[model samples]
Target: MTALLSFWPLFRRQIGRLGLTLLLSVLTLAAGVALLWVSGWFLTAAALTTAGVSFNLFGPSSLIRGLSLVRILSRYGEKLIGHDATLRLLSTLRSWLFGRLFPRVPLAGRDLRHGDLVSRLTADVDTLDTVFLTAFGPLLTAALIGAGMAAGLFMLLPAAGPIYAATLILALIGVPALLLWLSRRIGAELVEASAALRILTLDRIDGHADLVAFGAMAESDRDFEAATRRLARARRGLGRAGTLAALAVQALAGMALIGTLWCGITALRHGEIDGPLLVGLLLAVLASFEATAMLVRSVGKFGAAATAAQRVRAIAQMRPAITDPKRPVALKQGDLAFNQVTFGFDPARPVLRELSLNLLSGERVAITGESGSGKSTLLALALRLHDPQVGSIEIGSTDIRTVSQADLHAHVALLSQNAPVFLGTLRDNLLIGRAEANDAELWSALEAARIADFVRALPDGLDAFVGEAGRTLSAGQARRLCLARVLLSPAAVLVFDEPTAGLDRETELDFLGDLAAATRGRSVILATHAQIPPGAVDKVYELADGRLSSRPSMRG
Candidate 1:
């Protein structure tokens, strides 16, 4: 019930379009009933003439032709209006769901796989088309058509009217309610099965290299097969539920037909109703059951669509662990300070404890320590990726938490140990740091990073395509490309976290010299455990057991 209710707001927002569609559907059904009643009248006129009764009310051919034309026109209008409204409603829903997902992305990022998230946003949301086309449209049309049939029957034969009404009410209302209850259980199982299958498929693709390297390809295939089997079982259960609901509707229609026949026969004997009226009543009763059967199928479709809606709602409702301040302060020159700051990715296990540091403008500071000594954590704090639980970090004169993240990042540029190499041309990647830079500027940045010669050696020069995750380039080449990107940013402060971690000795020295030359007048913070180059830095800080202290230059 709760899952079904969540779609109400989405439905209400599109009520204008839905209402128009509903009106057209009602008109279509009314025309169909009028045609059926008129055809019966024409048949009765022919019968009376054969029996020598002089009752020529009207021409049978004209009435039948006119009703048929009206029915065809109404059906065409219904198709045109209903489909137009459905498409407009679908577009609105897609936009709303995307807006809701964007703000909560960071919070949900860690918990969801990339492939699975993409599937839910696209394939899962598309399932709601069934709700619009089959459920909402058919359900409304059935109700209106059933009511009209009952009223017409009453005017023709009083006792037959109540019986037809009761049968319709039970088929359209009672049977659907019971089927929906059963569908809820089936829907839940299907949701779980599909989610598991999506995750497993993504995992297999991402871990393909690992599985092959460890000779576990067979095991991986087995797991994927298990997930597929579970999904198939759940789908079969939902199909079975649909079949049962259909059978129940058919049984009710048969019973209604039997009761209507019995009453029509009694009326014929007493001369209360003529033979033509009885035939018309029987035809109307049978035709009305078609709408009831459509209603039953629609209820089952709604149940399946409700499952998809719940998953989408869960993603939309997540609150980010980090949120921008209501009123953010602007950042200027980058003079960073950490005052007794402490933090942890997990609260129970601290990564940094009461750390304090300060760096002035244009000062090249080196942070060196053993592995797991909170080197990367300090850089993350400076970038404001995560907030400190205990103290404060300030860039220039403003606290980081008081300023917008974009403003804070504009003052600082970071090139981490695992620098992300996006899939693009050399020129494309460099332009990310400074979008307005021309070709001349891109070549200049590449030359400064000591990789211009290598880039020019390629067949396409700056336009060469780097495959996914820069797979086409070596680790050293990829690292230099990242450095070239940061160099083009021209920020006041630069932080390099183990930038030369996996480079060859010759490449490392050349890159270090280029970095030292490019960052002469800028504030530079290098976090590394490698031996520091002489004349490359102005000051050095070594961290031990969460405590930081200044150290003498290696040159001395």
Candidate 2:
């Protein structure tokens, strides 16, 4: 339950809307109780008056009609308004959560991490609906109605109100305490089991081909089945706890009904209250208990909501690996540089040690190295995907960290194997590079990347769909498309990580030539093991001995 407190800020953001929903719910409940309470008095008074001499009927009849109309109208308004407000809040919350999640996604080797994050952003975010709709909304409405009912009873019969109050407290407080206690562990377990099931399921689906090729499908199936079973078990435990809490509330209601009746009879015998009022009070108790009935079961869901809240809060609280300085420095030019930078994935083994280099504007350079050498890490550091542990990487004499992230990215854009080619149309995917770019500009960039003729020949042209991860295109085609995306950027420094990795030798050289033409007058850093042709680049550097090399070498 404590974990759910983190959502208070989010709730407060929509407090005005939520407050209206709560108001409607209370009005709906109060009107229904009032209708039944007044009807009871009207019927009893009418019967007694018919049996005796003269009795006033107009006042009771008018009140009964008015309350009945209020009950129907308020009920309709309550459901419509309450549901609208809550659904809108959930929609806004989902958008906000995705905004928080987008920049925080881990890029490299993200199998389980991706799955876990998806579960949190999707299912776990959806679970927060329970917090507003099932937990707080119902509970708050029930408390308000209960208090009003208690006060009404106290004015009618002093002793009967105390009895009703005791029962209300037992239903609202005591039963919920037990329900929460019983549900906490089971609810947490349910959340874990659910998240585990989603992750394993996603992992299998994402890696189905590999598992089948390796003859490991049976083991994955078994793991999936086991996770599903655990989730089912936890759900059943929570269901049982919910059932027990409901029964306890029903029992408390029964006690309250019996106690109210006993108090009424004793008071009538002592001439303390009249018969019409007694029947009205009895009916009021019955109708008012209905208002709190759902709340008793809703208490158990607080535990489930708390578990989900903790998971979501965990992700929301994650700090980014790179962030802008409090006071930003504006970069005045496009020259990129690395000054004595050092970094290691593990503290004991360094991948890049005192690595320093420069790429002046309009210069094209290549970094060639063996697989383990850190060519890719150098580009990643320069892109500020990861910060250097020891040195400063600067653009135009301003440290990257001392500049706004958006401003840094505006100058330095990296196109790599890691760049996402989403499931969308070619035009939609290209527009991600620059939203304001026109069709003519897009075609020009694609032509420079050497893929424009192919797209032009297609029936849909820019409207043609690029399947998931651009799987519909060949390896060379996807690379060219990604290059076109970077070409569309307003960046001055363009970094390519293994831009033409798997192409044939002739195609690789042709692609490099195309790249040279496309990147004219822009700073380019190509991190690849492939050898580049003579006139394609200004300088060639190899990653060896933990630094760049000036001399040509066939070591890699």
Candidate 3:
């Protein structure tokens, strides 16, 4: 119920459109009921008449034709309006969910898998189509049709009208309440099983290479089969519940029909009611039953859509851990400072302990440390990826936390280990840093990164495809391409994390020398464990035992 209510605001915004659709749907339903009643009345009236059933075909034919036209037109109008309104509502909902999700993604604590997030965005949002198409439409139609049936029954046979109304109320209210209770547990279980299957399938696909190498393909298949079987069992339970609910509704409709007929016969024998009016009442009762059945099916679909809505809401409501200050500070020369910073990815396990450092403008500093010694972590702080628990990171005399992430990145360029290589031409990837860079500027940056000859060697030159993640390129070439990206950017600060990793000594030194020369007038922080090239950096800082210490030049 709470989850259903959450969708009302968006629904209310489109109420005018929904109301128009509902009016058309109701008119269509009413026309069908009237046609059935009038046709039955005419056939019975002619049979009982002494004129041998050949009196007025024109009147009955006209009514039938008009009813048919109304039914078709109303149904067409209803579908057009209903689908248009639903699409608009869905668009609004997806926009709202995306707006809420963007800020939370950088800080969401849950280890959300990429595949799971994709499922939420695509599959989960799509499931909500049933909420409007099935649930809201049928519910509104049932209410209007049930009300009209009750009023028409009273006009025909006053004694039985109350009984018919009570029966309908019970079916509409009591049956749904009972079914909701029973299916709540089953629905929740099915949803969980479905999510588990998604996660397992995605994991298997992502780790396919590893599984094949280890000969664990059969084991993975068994696990997936188990998940599928669990989901099947849950679906079977849901089917059984639906069957039972349908049976209950049908039984109630039978009782209502029988009771109405019995009362009608008594009234007719007592000379208190006519045959035509009783027949009309009976037809309306059956039509109401049809509407009730649709309502039940709609409710079941709503249950499924409600489960999906909850998952989307959970993701859309998460708050980001880091947000720009209301009044953001602008960065200038990129002089960075870390003041007594003590931080950790997890609170109990500290990565940097009261660590502090400072970098002057136009200086090239190389940070070297053992694995897990917080070298990359320090660079992350400079980039403001995570805020420290107790201390501050400042850029050009302003705390980075006081600046927006966009502003921070605008002034600083970071080329981390395993830099992302998108699938596109070499020029496409290089121009990502500076979108307006011309052919000359691109070749210049590529040459400066020591990869111009390699780029020229390709048949298409700058137009050559790098393939996915640059899989076609060698490790050193990929690294140089990433460096070219950073070099092309106009940022004041450049931080390279292991830029020379996985390269030969000569190639590593040449790239380092080129990078240092390219950013001669800017602040550059090179976080690497490789030996620094002679005269490549203004200073060298080694991080050991969770502290930064200056190292004497080995070349001197």
Candidate 4:
């Protein structure tokens, strides 16, 4: 419940739409109750009146028709408006969640699986639709209708009013409270089990080949069966709890009806109220309980919604590893420098110690090192993906930390070792590099990356749809496609980690040979284990033992 409140600000944005939906829901319920009440009174009076005795049929008949029409129209409007507003709210939530998620990428120390994250973003968000659409609106409408019915009973049959109100109050509050308390643990378990099943399914799908190769298909099947069983058990428990709560509500409704009937009959014996009005009140009471029925059905879902809300809010509450400065300094064109920078995943064992280097504007420098020698870590620091433990990185003589991360990123772009070619058309993926780039610019970047001829040969050309992670293309082609995206970025400094990876030796040398011409006028930081050809870069350095030493360009 508290978790649901955290999203109140986002909910408040749709107040006007939600308010109208709520009003229509109330109208729908009210009309239904009134329609039932009028119908009962009209039929009873018509039957009791003597033949040809002056009895008004036109008024009661007219009200029944009007209420029936109102119920239909208002029910339609409620469904239409409620669904529209709920969908719009969900869309906004996804966008808001993604906006927060981006800055927290490489979420250090949070061992969140990809499949689990997907579940949170998609299934969990969908569960929240019940929060307002089903649970909140129905509960409030039930209360309103119940209160109205109680007030009318008090005015007409004073003896039954208190009894009806008390029973209704118990049905509305006590039943749901009991349901929530009973279902709370099981509901949370149900959500976890569902997410676990999803995660396992995704994992098996992704690792199908490995499982087959290792002859572990039987083991995987057993694991999957276990997860399914857990999910089934949790679902069964929640269902039982919901069933009990619904029964409790029905029991309370029975009590209210029987008590009202007894009080009305007693009043009739004393010449207090007539049969026609008594029948009408009894029918209205039954119809009014319809609202509580809807609420009971939706309350079962509220438990799950609360669990989903907690999962979603957990992610939203995480503090981002990086944030922009309050008063950011504008970056200017100058040398990129690392001044006595030191960092480590565990501070006691530093990956880079007192690392200091400088790359002048427009200079191409290559850093070669063995695996785990902090090459990628150093590049990450330069991009401010993670701040240094003990020192400052400066661009143009200003501390990089002093400038906004967005400004710093605009000045620098990176193509990491495992860079992805997202699932989209060639043009769509390239647009991510520079949304405003013209076709000519895209073509030029593709050509520079040595993949332009391949795309041109395809029937769709730039419009060719690349499968997920560029699965449709060969590994070498996919790497080149990602390289093209980095090349398309409008930045002064271009950083590549294993830029020529996946290419054949000959092609690797060719690309490296043309590196100077390909990235002309931009500062380049290349980290790789590949040999650097002569004149490919302005300087070469070897990284070993968390420090750099100047080295001559190596011959391929």
Best by lDDT: 4
Q: Write the per-residue lDDT of candidate 2 for residues 1-556, one digit (tens) a residue.
A: 6668867877787787678778878887888888778888878877877555467678877887887787688767767776776677688768777677556654343333777877887877777864777888888888899999999888888788888999999888888888889999998899889889988988998999999999999999899999999999999999999998888888888888888889999999999988988898898898888867878778877777888888887776666556678998886786888999888776467788898898899998889889989988898888788887889998888888888878878888889866778799999988888999999999999999999999998899999998999998887888888889999999999999988887888888888877778999899998887777767778888888678878552321
lDDT, candidate 4, residue 547?
Answer: 92
Stretches of candidate 2 exceeding 4 Å from the true structure:
1-3, 39-69, 91-112, 270-277, 369-373, 396-398, 422-428, 435-440, 450-481, 500-511, 529-536, 539-556
Could you tell me which residue pairs clash in candidate 1? none
Candidate 3 global CA lDDT score? 0.83
lDDT of each: 0.80, 0.83, 0.83, 0.89
- Which number leads on TM-score? 4
> What TM-score does prediction 3 earn?
0.81
lDDT (C-alpha) at residue 196 in model 4: 95
Tens-place lDDT digits, model 1, residues 1-556:
5765777777777677677777766776666666676677567656766654665556656776876787778777767776776676678778888888765644522677776687677756776744766887788788889888888777877777778888888888888888888887787777767877888888888888999999999998898899899889877887888788889888877877778778878888989888877777777677777777888877877666787878777777777556789998787676788998888777666677888888899888899999998898789788877788898998776898988877777788999988888888878899999999999999988887778999999999999999889999988789889998998986888999999898888777766766777777888899987777776778899977776889996552
Question: What is the total number of backbone clashes in candidate 2?
Answer: 0
Reference-based lDDT, residue 286, model 1 = 75
Query: What TM-score does each of the candidates earn?
Result: 0.75, 0.85, 0.81, 0.89
RMSD versus native structure for model 1: 5.5
Ranking by TM-score: 4, 2, 3, 1
lDDT of model 4 at position 539: 88
